[model samples]
Target: MTDLPFDPIQLMREHPEKMHIPGGLLTKQGPQDYVGGVPAITGTLFFNDAHTAEVREAICACFDEYEVIAKAHLTWLWRAEPPEGPDKFVYEKAPSMRAMIKRMNENDLVSFTYVSGKQPHDAGDWEFQVFGRRGWEAKMIVRGTSALRFTMPLLHVEKNPAAFQAMFVSFAKRLKALHGYGGQGLVLSAPRESDNQPFEAYLANMLNGLDVGEPVGATRSAHLGIKTVSWLTAVNHKMIEKIGGLSAIRSELPMDWFALYDYGAGLVVQAGPKPEGAPADQPKPARLVLPNMLFKEVRAPKVSLHYASKEGEPRLIGWGAEQWLQRFDVPEDEVQAYKARLLDEPKLTKATTLPDRL
Candidate 1:
């Protein structure tokens, strides 16, 4: 648990033929040069417009708590056009970071990617990303409000789930988040590009619990709604009411295993002691039954995943993407029967198949 199940960056390096162009150019130097490789635990918080100041402070606090900069070799900033960009903007020093965030205007994008390693330019052991769109409603074609997203290495969460939960709650309260989900997921080497998604879809199919879609895209489509259930699912006061009161939810999700933590603005529902990912070869994920029930109650829609792929690699797009999203959905009439079957299934064990060998 101290390490990722597999090194994603290494996968790209070992299978360069499998990688797409442009975005995959960053990996041309091999896995050890770039920062990202580990599987990630991501949290995406959505809220109303104009709270960039608070979000900036929260990010700083989080970085300070984790000593993110001390371990990071590369820090990237994304900008739209001239004055803001001619090439990728790379900055050093905390003062500049704070200034960059402070000057952000309405509808302006705030993006940062930190590549962390024990030594400068060393193979990245962990990767962290921050993305938010201030007053996005006026700018985005999809009409999204505003969102703050964080991606942390899975090793960190595996080390301390409690601490991770606390950090998430802290963010939800400060951002006054409307809704969000956090758990196992893949972090792209070049997140802004579509290159890594084909690989993501392949992995997601094998590891059904992993969320493979881009967080910013989810923010646009799932405004004030649930995206998908995960280890930690947060819903605001308004959403809690729509899904039946807190008590009603609590009654359905047994208190013995499911822990509900209040974050002032909303509450986070923790499915179990830790995040769970059921590999395709393993027994059906009985663990997800309760979470899926919540997903149904919240009326979460089938999420979309990127479709672009290499010549003959595994692809999840169009109708394929639709099937992946509905994998956990149980029909209304079959809910009881489905729950019974899932609940009675055996748990994953030492013999359970793992995706590491793939």
Candidate 2:
């Protein structure tokens, strides 16, 4: 249970509040979801900025989900243990997503990191690392020696208004050209905040670097040194306007499972899955619509669409409802066949009892 007593570092599936884990963010059975789901919304902390201290200040102000448990070797690169202090981030205690959001009602944070090889060793002796301290299941682990570390306070939703929107537009067009169409819109969740950056951009800038550092400009935070977990709860419309808009978007959106959630700073969509082995642009990720993970003790979401609504807005509907769906990672043609056998029906009704999310 979210508020009920439980261990922090234990498997989340064991917790009542953490059930229905967002796709990709969790170590699920299959590929992560990308077509319109809260899993697409990612909150990041930028480590490196034009200004550094302001960035660190901004980062410390909000949620500290990362506790430096102990520095040691994980499977591949480096991993940092949670800091041994009350000031460090703790999911169950203070500095929660809600508390940090309250502290950062008007500001955001950034941090800087650098990776370098050990000076005296054979160039691979030791490496510096920065862990995103992302939620338990999925995480962001960066390694280097020295330079600028950008702690990204990023939420991966649909396309970024400015850049990603254009990329999605192009992908949508290519799909149209191929004569492919679908009922559900695209859904994407990035472990790192900037995963929202077009896949091409990532390949070009971060991976391939043909246009190295091309995306440097987009990583800059709006309020330097300012921090707020609430930024994640900011109005999606405003964030879309600042970043760009939906005019250029072309990804298919299926009406049945599609639902939109404005989680401050961004809007998230609950989308259907795409055909298997499709390109990044055409028929985006297929996903079963899942509800935003909630805390059992708190009645409202810590960062929610309603929390961002304008003052004195009309009565709300379709919010914080308790419905869940079982996602399938099968082929498009087989999805219906599989559903018929598993659910034994084409649609869900009040009688269907779903599993509780961990």
Candidate 3:
């Protein structure tokens, strides 16, 4: 058996509670406890016929050498050779370990298996059983079309986020080194709690705080007046599009902020207070309300604007209300009239001026 790169047994021996199991096997299996709060780190790898043998060998060798005892549940899929017959694939689950191992050794059958170090398993269809018995558990399932998804549950990531992040980075790097893999090597974590929000949403919130330097609990509320909201929404939407959606933004910015509204006309975001020790110059939030018509119109390519700054400008500078009205194709006289009307409104005046520094 080949040696594993990491010694899971040593890690488990040192921290049994993290794994949600007693220190030794001698402890009888008492009533099972709920491990709901833990976050699970997951990813998928794609393999083809050329790398199948090597992939299987590496997984089996790692488990065999690590002293990680695994309960294997095997499956086999057989497809008829093409042409003469319809290319139908038949699936079969082995009734016993002996039968599964026998099929695996046969070499002709396309086999997949779930291996775990713990018992009383009740994983869903897409869940995989990871082998290492550490403070966490792992699961892998075969996603048809030669894709394999692996899930590793981190018992207390919220308590030791730095450690959890480090583990995920290391694991992702190792997995990417496997044969026949391509793409950027995806990895995702489930929500820490039962909230059903997509991972992308969670990621977007984090990015708002880290990348955009937004304040926590600060929001682009309706009070900012419609003009400012319209302009900021347009600019932010452009930035988000350039960055490739909210989830991609999260990768670049890992701070935490709640995105009350991320799609459709505009975004309404709120985040917790600034993290302790954040830099003093971080951008602060300004209240704004995006106009529905502007949001819709800016989606087209024809609309554009630029921020202009002048010496002693009110620390805020942007297109004037008249310029924006013109951009909306308002009549020249009407644009002037609207600008005159806005000048008398303090909130509208403040909204039109873009912050000198964002």
- Show where candidate 1 strays beyond 4 Å: 1-37, 50-95, 117-125, 134-142, 300-304, 307-315, 333-358
1-358 per-residue lDDT for model 3 (tens digits): 1122333234333542343321111112212232221123333322223124444444344323222211232122212222122222222332432233333421233333342222222121112312211111111212111323343333332243233222222222333321111111112111111111122122222222111101110111111222222111222444345436566534322222211223222232221111111112432221111122223233322111112222222111133323332223433344344434433322422222212212
Candidate 1, residues 264-322: lDDT per residue as tens digits? 88788766666667566665454565667655666445454564554544456667877
Query: Per-residue lDDT tens digits of candidate 2, residues 17-114?
Result: 23222222212222233311111112222222212333333333321222121122111122123222232221223233224323431223211121
Off by over 4 Å in 2: 1-58, 61-63, 68-110, 114-215, 220-235, 239-256, 270-358
1 against 2, candidate with superior lDDT: 1
lDDT of each: 0.57, 0.22, 0.25
TM-scores, one per candidate:
0.74, 0.24, 0.25
Candidate 3 regions with alpha-carbon error over 4 angstroms: 1-39, 49-51, 61-121, 124-145, 159-358
- How many angstroms is residue 281 displaced in model 2 relative to the true structure, after the best TM-score fit? 9.5
lDDT (Cα, 0-100) at 188 in candidate 3: 17
